[model samples]
Target: MKKESKVFGIYPVIEALKANKTLDKLYVQKDIQNPKIQSIINDAETLSITINEVPIEKLNRLTKGNHQGIVAIISPISFPPFEDTVETILATKETPLFVVLDQISDVRNFGAILRTAECTGVDAVIIQKKGGAPVSGDTVKTSAGAIFNIPICKVDHIKDAIFYLQGSGITTVAATEKSGSYLYDLDLKKPLALIMGSEGRGISKSVLSIVDKSASIPLLGTINSLNVSVACGTFLYEVIRQRNH
Candidate 1:
């Protein structure tokens, strides 16, 4: 198992938040009552940081010292601002390609997607800050260090990122079996951002509603579904094929 970097106690977490530190998640002791803790929770919520009301034993296992009913897991990697990453990629790449993940909670799947994104020349990978998997040690290892090479953007909402991409002349496409069109039929040579949804649920309905188009990979087999990471590679390779041909 990979050891996670942690910040325990109340004031330290507050200062970390104030300094704009990239935290994977904040774990607070369940049933604790304190005004300062409430303030911390509010601040964390505003920043879209994931919070878990865990037992004190969980906090104790995370660290040895007195936790003061709070502990924060620091992200192994920093996330670039979403708007800044988009603007930079748009300015630099002629036909920028991006990957937008909607609530991919599995660390291994997220890492696999990142590896594929880097391999397929994706401009950036965008994920929501709270609902998605943290950029932790497992993610880094699973990605084979591709996380360091590719720029990852953390956004407040997937829909916001899609709207921004659309406004910037990037066509947003969702990969879902619910779609009537096949992935091969799309013109993906242009600037594009491919959206991959979570494991249990495919793309969210609101996100599917706003995308430029929705595409599905053909499934001749009886499975009728694919692993999110495998499906992501299928989508990315199709984009590569379209662009190369």
Candidate 2:
């Protein structure tokens, strides 16, 4: 497992948040109660930080000293704002292609998608700040340094990103097995952003509700669904194929 940049102890974590640090995720012991913990929770919620409730044993395993029932991981890279990134993309490209990752927690999977996005001429890769994988050294290594080459936008919620893209006239398409629609049915040559969810659970219901379209890949074998990275490659190449034809 990749080691994360973290801050343990209650007061240190609170000070980090007060300094407006960019945190990847926050882990709090389940059922932890204290004035400081309450303050931390309020700050995290206000900042739209992702919080995970873990057992006390898990907290003990993470650190030897006093963790004070809380830990926060600081992200290595600075995430760009969605609106600015979109504006920049529109200024240069007539029809831009972007990718959004929702609940894809594996750093390797996230890195692979980013690599594909870079190769396929994708304008950007958007992710939900809380649920998505943290961008770290492991991610950069897996991507073969492609993560640095690509632009990433981290938003508070996946659904919000979908709505923002739509408002900008960028067509949104989500990959889900539940949808009766086929990937080839829609024309993807226009300005668009593709939403890909994790294999365990496809796009969240709230996100699916807002997407312009939902599509599924054709499967011939016994496997129920395709790995997200593979499916993402197929989607991007299809866009390229349509534009070339």
Candidate 3:
């Protein structure tokens, strides 16, 4: 998908809906009570497109041009529901390996991480509806089309997702510098959901409180931290290594 193909305006998105175009996701301004907007929302819901309520600033940043408080991401591939993806993983009888991204806003970083996750056989990629990278054309390009292959779930809150995963018997692990245990020490052979946070801010405090195990990659160099995408690769491969053994 190219940059121009990603539609980000209220009218454009509504038109897409009217035309029955396949959309990856849709972002609507929070607290919008307008009847017309509600009609659009209703139409989108009828089509079963993933819709999220976000702040107006997020919509502006997605497109500097007039977005009219709405943005729709058109994707070549349709996204699956979070529950369905989880169920599919379990049905296949494979250890559920999922990735939860906390507020990772950069498109390139998001795409790169998706590429790594796809290569590592991750079942699904979970991200918050707000404060995360918009699934734009650049992200698709950066992932080298891996985004189409991988199932990405946009949730209302990461904490809620963690709770759901825990309820489903999946162990949740947070990869952060604050962790005392090293990544290599964790047993990743079981059903697992690996959480990676944003570049500027680490994992959110609420999310950190819920993770079952917290582990970190041992840094050998003087650098205090690793790039978010690189760190994701390391953590994912560690899971692969452990599962193989």
Candidate 4:
């Protein structure tokens, strides 16, 4: 993490939020009750940022100095609005590719997927503002600096993003084991968006119904499923393969 990226203590964080700074995430000490801190929580929620109430020791480990109960991690990159980004990409690329992440909060997995998304030339990555992984140091490092290169779009909800994409003449594809159709069966040559979920609860039932195609990565072994990042990489490369041929 860069030295100037984080603000320690409650007042600093609260002021940062009031100033409308782009905050990636916020961590507060569990069970601490103060009116000012409550204000911070309200502001963070209003901005749709992910918040965690961790042990005080966790906050202490984040910095050598005193934390005063709250710490705000500033994002190095600013995310574009989901609607504007979609409109811009649709205007340019003939067969634009977008990646939609559903409740995938693991920073490492999110970072790795960003790397693959960048490699595959994805126009932008769409993630839910609240439950998705925060743009933190760990995520940035795991992405191998791809976070800086790729356009990240923050949306109010994953469903809204999907609906908007489909409305704009983009096909939405979901990767989940519940589907019988293999990834190769899907036609990705057209403008499309790929939706990937967390390892815990694949894709939401509502989201599954909205996707244009439900695809699965064929697994030969006994393993039930593949890691989210690995599955995303496999599907992205398959799109490349189909477009080239």
- Candidate models: Cα lDDT each: 0.91, 0.86, 0.86, 0.89
| TM-score of every model versus the real structure | 0.90, 0.87, 0.80, 0.93
Error of 1 at 220 (Å): 2.1
- Candidate numbers, best TM-score first, in rank order: 4, 1, 2, 3
lDDT of 3 by residue, 1-245 (tens): 44425677667877888787777678889998778778888988777666889999898888788877788887655556788778877889558899999999898999999999999999899987666877777888889989888899877789998999999899999989999999988889999999999999989888999999999989889988999999999999988888887
The lDDT leader among the candidates is: 1
Count backbone overlaps in model 2. 0
TM-score of 3: 0.80
Q: Please identify which of the two predictions, 1 or 2, would achieve the higher lDDT against the true structure.
A: 1
Per-residue CA lDDT of model 4 for 16-132, tens digit only, reads 877888898888999998898888899788788878899999999988778888888998788888888888888888999999999897999999999999999999999887777
Off by over 4 Å in 2: 1-4
Error of 4 at 170 (Å): 0.6
How close to the true structure is residue 89 of candidate 1, measured as C-alpha lDDT?
A: 86
Candidate 1 local lDDT, 69-144, one digit each (tens): 9999888777788899899988899999999999999999999999999999998999987777878888988898
Candidate number achieving the greatest TM-score relative to the actual structure: 4
Q: Against the true structure, what is every candidate's RMSD?
A: 2.4, 2.6, 3.9, 1.9
lDDT of 2 by residue, 1-245 (tens): 33347789999998888888787778899998888898898889888788889998988887787998998888666678889999999999999999999889888888889888999999899988776777776787778777777888888778888888999999999988888988999899889999999868888898898899999888889988988999999999999999999
* Positional deviation of residue 176's Cα in model 1 after best superposition, in angstroms: 0.2
lDDT of 1 at 75: 81
Per-candidate clashes come to 0, 0, 0, 0
Against the true structure, candidate 2 reaches a TM-score of 0.87
